[model samples]
Target: MRTALLLAAFLCGPALADRQSFPPVDEADRDPSLVEFRETLLAKIAARDVDTIVALACPDIYLSHGGDGGPEELRANLVLDPQTLSEEYREDADAMREQYWTDLENTLSQPGYFDDEGEFWMPHQWQITLPASLDAHLAYFVTGQNVSLRQQPNRDAPLITRISHEVVILRDHQSSAEYQRVLLTDGTQGYMHSDFLWPMTGHRAAFVKSDAGGWQLCTFVSGD
Candidate 1:
């Protein structure tokens, strides 16, 4: 009987795990200094105040997995020089630059948390850990409450269900599409609004306080 119960638990485990939810919790208020710092930094980002933004960054701010991260790279990314782009990408230079700024603003606007090290990271969902067996690249989080999962990729389509803060698998993402196709863990496939789904590997930012008691932008990056 014990062996049979163990097998039953094993068989039921995946479904139980699939129903797990990660709700957003913002611990930013735990530190008043971080609140002030983030507010100022967000305003600077909004105004595209390069000088202020650069100054707020740590000397060795991390921007990517293999990027040579620092103030210079941050400036270049924000400035978006057309000449720096390859011939093919130059035509879309303006849009690309705008996207950088928009992404930064949106990322910073999300709720955040303070780690054990006291460093603050934004988009509270970033802290969710996926199972090792799941492919991180294909996983996404529904960052909305009572979000519609439609039968088709349109607003008028039939509603399959409503997903809250849950993990879903996305095989392909069309950047220009208003809705994204996703598969729930229970094998229910449907469409969700693109805006409600945040790629598990999406951009997130971190703020760390220096010994001098001032916060700095320590990391702003995406991907695994």
Candidate 2:
């Protein structure tokens, strides 16, 4: 309760006495508590206070491909050191540290990014699914369908694989018609058909206001 008030105070700053409002929702019925919570949480995110960020989470959290289950793990994930990742994934994870946080802060600061349910549509977190010689390359998600992988640049090369889903992607440092290079999550280096992969918005973190009017993260999952 005290923490929530402190956060509200921090955001309100003496600059203005007027209560700030959220992005206007089209729906007439919106929860005031949820709106307030979302505003406070976004404020803390812009400030990059990971500790307070962790405190805003529910006891059980769901951080896809990154972390899960409780505030402690979420804190660890946020402040995770590259050395802490598995030996193979360490290098890539460390390389992405800067961009990841930058995107996160950017997303948090965007208005109307949240829904009626107060789920925040965060920026995509590009991850290294494996340890490969990707150099300083980041991963890209496959956003199209019927994507093909060929053994060589030609259309007649052996069909290595076909991607039939959205958002399932590999780390591709380079692109070409003959060989669309990719690194799988299991350290497999191969070529997929070119032009299927594209970056997409990341999953959402849903926050619910507790009985005390303090907002807390309840769930997280891949979003549209």
Candidate 3:
């Protein structure tokens, strides 16, 4: 029995260690200045005040992994002029622009934390560091408590477990499907509602304090 127990522990130890939960915490209120700045920026974004929004960004804001990230690129991305696209793709220009705006607004609205450099990063989950061996594209965070892990893709399926603020491996994600197939770190496989799963590579933004003691949008990009 002792030998059997030891073997079991050895088999499960690494998997258990890989399972970690990173709950969201909002630290924006820690700095009154940041809180006020964020509120004003959010309002401007909602109103699509292009000039004011561009003015709030750093002179060389980082908007993507590869690109000349400056106010010009930011403006182009925000405006998404249909005239610039091929005639075939022009019909969806409005949707593309709206998506970019929505992504920015939603990301900033999420709870955020202050990094070591004193920069504030949003959507709280952006701070999580996954195991290097894990495939980043396959990992997702459960954003809710007692979120059901169903035995099948449908709600009426048997309950496998309830996950809360934990990392789960996604086997597959269908954008139109309501439930996503997922695998728990313990080797249990199930389906979870799509709404509660946030991809680790999802959009995240950062705000930095300028030399004049004002906050500016510094980074707003997604992916690894």
Highest-TM-score candidate: 1
Clash count per candidate: 0, 4, 0
In model 1, residue pairs whose N, Cα or C atoms come closer than 3 Å (at least 3 residues apart or on different chains), thus clashing, are none
Ranking by lDDT: 1, 3, 2
Clashes (candidate 3): 0
After aligning candidate 1 to the native by TM-score, how far in Å is the CA of 181 from where it should be?
A: 1.5
Q: Which ten residues in a row have the lowest lDDT in candidate 3?
A: 1-10
lDDT of 1 by residue, 70-144 (tens): 999999999989999999999999999999999899998899887778888988877777655566788888999
For candidate 2, give the lDDT: 0.50
| Candidate 2 lDDT, 72-118, residue by residue in tens | 87676667788888888887885566555564554444332344454
TM-score pick, better of 2 and 3: 3
Task: State the weakest 10-residue window (summed lDDT) of model 2.
Answer: 1-10
Full-model lDDT for every candidate: 0.84, 0.50, 0.84
List per-candidate RMSD values in Å: 5.4, 17.8, 6.0
Error of 1 at 104 (Å): 0.6
